[model samples]
Target chain A: MLDHPTRIGRLALVGLGLIGSSIARGARANDLVDTIVAIDRDPAVLERVRTLGLADHVTDDLAAGVAEADLVILCVPVGAVGPVTAALAGALKPGAILSDVGSVKGAVMAAAAPHVPDHAAFVPAHPVAGTEQSGPDAGFATLFQGRWCILTPPEGTPPEAVARVRGFWEGLGSVVETMTAAHHDLVLAITSHVPHLIAYNIVGTAADLETVTQSEVIKFSAGGFRDFTRIAASDPTMWRDVFLNNKEAVLEVLGRFNEDLAALARAIRWDDGDALHALFTRTRAIRRGIVAMGQETAEPDFGRRGAKG
Target chain B: MLDHPTRIGRLALVGLGLIGSSIARGARANDLVDTIVAIDRDPAVLERVRTLGLADHVTDDLAAGVAEADLVILCVPVGAVGPVTAALAGALKPGAILSDVGSVKGAVMAAAAPHVPDHAAFVPAHPVAGTEQSGPDAGFATLFQGRWCILTPPEGTPPEAVARVRGFWEGLGSVVETMTAAHHDLVLAITSHVPHLIAYNIVGTAADLETVTQSEVIKFSAGGFRDFTRIAASDPTMWRDVFLNNKEAVLEVLGRFNEDLAALARAIRWDDGDALHALFTRTRAIRRGIVAMGQETAEPDFGRRGAKG
Candidate 1:
């Protein structure tokens, strides 16, 4: 076995939410970071972090939290990335690497780039992993295991800094991929953002229906709506920021989705069973590919039955 | 324990897909039926059912299979309910209660009603439970445990038949509810049909994207797309029939969904984070209600992580 040295010294995390705390936990569990400093605007969150012992130090002060850190990651909502970076950029150590875990990369890059000092490299990354749950306690050390984390470093950034950021995420059990911020945003819009939007939209539609009572919808959700509700139940502030920041990509993908959905509705209206069957069959192949590639669980119903039984 | 008599003397299932095979397994495991006869249009399904020992008697002849059955369930797709009933209704035993497990109750009720013999009663039921898997091999004895089974017996049907059918489902561990077939279709249109359509649509859209490669979409699916893929991978013929049969209600609900989605799109375009946040927040409560009502798994990620680990 090869000796794995600590990749980050005095790692400072801004916002001890799900992503931030998971990074802290994963880094500590894997010995990837020498020291973890958890920073959040909420005092209660800082208190919870201390109680959970998730970090070596917990603070509400941005500058004090990040001072002298080898790596600083902003794990706040995409909308907050700009403000947080602006507030804390001046305090980043000369050689420290600045990164983030926002879902939308292009907006995050645009928001955070100007604030980042010339001495520090800004690497925007989106870890394509998370549960619908939020808060400090919702994170686990193994959350990033077997998941994809895309790093979108701006043009002309040092290769060593990009490589180091890649090493940090890989050390925490993530498979890192490098891509441009614009491409990352477009890819994520179809893969994550639009999916989440439709989920939220469907859940809202079901809830507001006058003919179907909420009680009936709740009782009968096991049919399919329950699955949508799981993702729709995700952190609202985070998702809201995601949609706002990734507006162009999300809307572009959503336009294609609407057009496809219209065709499906037309098929159903015209009683074109073959068309619906063809589409459904094609979709099944995509799922099989996802499962075969090990991105999704192979167990039926996500092995949800085992949890109950 | 109370002495529980067999609810069904001889059960004849018209299709040996996921629902049919599950009924056989649940019935046999709970001693709800003394004998089971599985009939399918496909000989392979019959052979598999026999190999699995899912039923005492397996055959492809619909009339021969229902010779002396006390209860005959048509577990075929919604589109086949009419033809299957027309083929088997003449053979139903006098005093036998007939039921079906189609998702669209109104269409099933209409299609099967005129063909029912004077001495036999028809009850259309929608079991609001299933995995995406299909076929006889994909079933388990506990599939219906603690799940909702809605019974829609046509008006003026004998009360005893409805009671006996309810008892049969309850014996198989389902919580039974009785409603009008029309209302059941309308409710399920929003709860199941439209949700399925959108899931299928989004998956198809993602698959057809020009800019984003399918590999990237599959790799980054954990962000939320994987959940949609699970349901989108369901039996194509079954779902295609569901949308075709429940066309009006599905179209009606889908219109409202489009309207709500348009509003959400407007909010995103205008960067109305508050509106997006409010909707996302409201949707979370619905998920809580689903979990509280025991209709969904409360464990995070549907316990998929545990399965992987």
Candidate 2:
């Protein structure tokens, strides 16, 4: 923890969705801020902020939320970042640090970095955690606990501002890692974007199968399809925005995924048992690595209980 | 709960893997059997069957396991159905009921139905529940609890055998449904096989990533990759056997899946946000339907806790 009296002066959170509300709660829970202000286009969202007590002040005006704030966080969908940044550009305090909790870094940086105050810190960041549930009610104080929040600061950004931003997230129980924009987008495309696309695609296929029927897919899903549905059940608008925003990285990994799937399809068609065995065997090790890395809990209860719903 | 003696006169289990051992244990746990005879050509498996106490008698000899069995269950991998059936054709008792717990029904019937004794019942069954884990120790008596069991009995099979087998699975707490063999295969190929292939492919892509290191993939897996690994962590040999045995239905579903995925990839490449959004939106309803049907639980705890290794 830095001794600079914390990054607790003032905070501006744009948007009042799940991610935004979670950050507000998380920031307040850790006493990491002096004042929290949230902005959303919908007055209903402001009412939610009031009811949830997630912020000190709430307004439908994005610009009004940034006034007097020392830190401005964009928590809107990726597609909205550009327009929202433009709206708040003139309202941010001179010494404020600007960051985001967007899913894709390159797109988000492209959208918001240009409008950042030259004297201020433009530390583009992505807190890599969320649920399929949406709206203000879906968030909680501990949403980012033990999750990774990647900070993709542009070159020559003020180091002190970056450290303070890092401290803010760290106090809320996130493990912050610094990454280049390209690497962050590429990593997330494989880890999140592409996988989500595949899940959506498979669920789409199941939905379209005239012979199989939707009822059958639902009934027999415990075999494995249930897992895909769980992921595909995510908010459509948010996911579409992510895949669209991270096009290059998503397509690159998706190409690789296509090749592998085609090879597997070939193995199945040719009845190449050994090739199938080898690939399946190789993947088991990766699963072990994930379990070892503490990313996925080893207990079946978490997965099963999620699938059960 | 019947008044008559609950003991099965003699039972033959055709494999000693996950589901097979689970059935053995469930039967033993429920006093549902008088004698259990397990068969497998693999030496290690025979040792496992004995080690797990899955049988009153165990052997690498197929004939020995089937010779006096009043009920014969083909619980081997889908690919093994044909060979095992051929091996045990002459050994089955005259009136013994022949059933299977294969994942793919049409193929199971194609492989085992022709060899069945005319007087014996051939009930093709699939219990649509499993963890990615496999092997004797991986099984528990509760594996089938609250799961769906599908029976694709041949057209002329005796009603009594179906009822008996249904009673057995019902005792284990599965809800049983009936469908034609071909229909069952197609339904499962879409619901189980294709989704598994998609998960396996995405996980494979993550493993092969040169851009994002494996450690990074593991660390950030909760972003989405972790769920795919849960499905991909399924047993290799068993899955290899599944694809090989259920070739037709799997190929058909895979064909549809690839076409749908290609369409989505094209939409992403061309920045067709509407198309992506529309498809994603459509699939979300299916998820809601699954939730309504009690197939999957909703996302309750988005705040992930550490895996208890």
Predicted candidate 2 versus true structure: per-residue lDDT over A203-261, tens digit per residue = 89888877777887888877888777766878777888898889999889888988888
lDDT, residue A140, candidate 2 = 84
Interface RMSD of each: 1.5, 2.4
lDDT at A151 for candidate 1? 95
- Residues B1-309, model 1: lDDT tens digits: 124543788999999999999999998888888889999989899889878999988888999999899999999989899988899888888999889999998877788799999989988888888999999999988899988999998889998889988988888888999999889999998888898999999999999999999999999999899899989999999999999889999999999999999999999999898999999999999999988877777888887843232
What is the TM-score, restricted to chain A, for candidate 1? 0.97
Off by over 4 Å in 1: A1-6, A305-309, B1-6, B306-309
lDDT of 2 at B32: 79
Each prediction's DockQ?
0.76, 0.61
TM-score of predicted structure 2: 0.94
lDDT per residue (tens digit) for residues B1-309 in model 2: 334333468889887778988898888887777889988777898898888778999988888779999888988788788778878888888888888888887777887788887767788889998878777777888888778999988787788888888888887778999998888888888888878877777888888878789889987887788888887888887788888878899989889888998999999889899999898888888878877776677655322456531
lDDT tens readout by residue for model 1, A238-279: 999999999999999999999999999899999899999999
**Top candidate when judged by lDDT against the true structure:** 1
Per-candidate Cα RMSD to the true structure, in Å, reads: 1.6, 2.5
Which stretches in model 2 have alpha-carbon errors above 4 Å? A1-5, A306-309, B2-7, B29-31, B38-61, B301-305
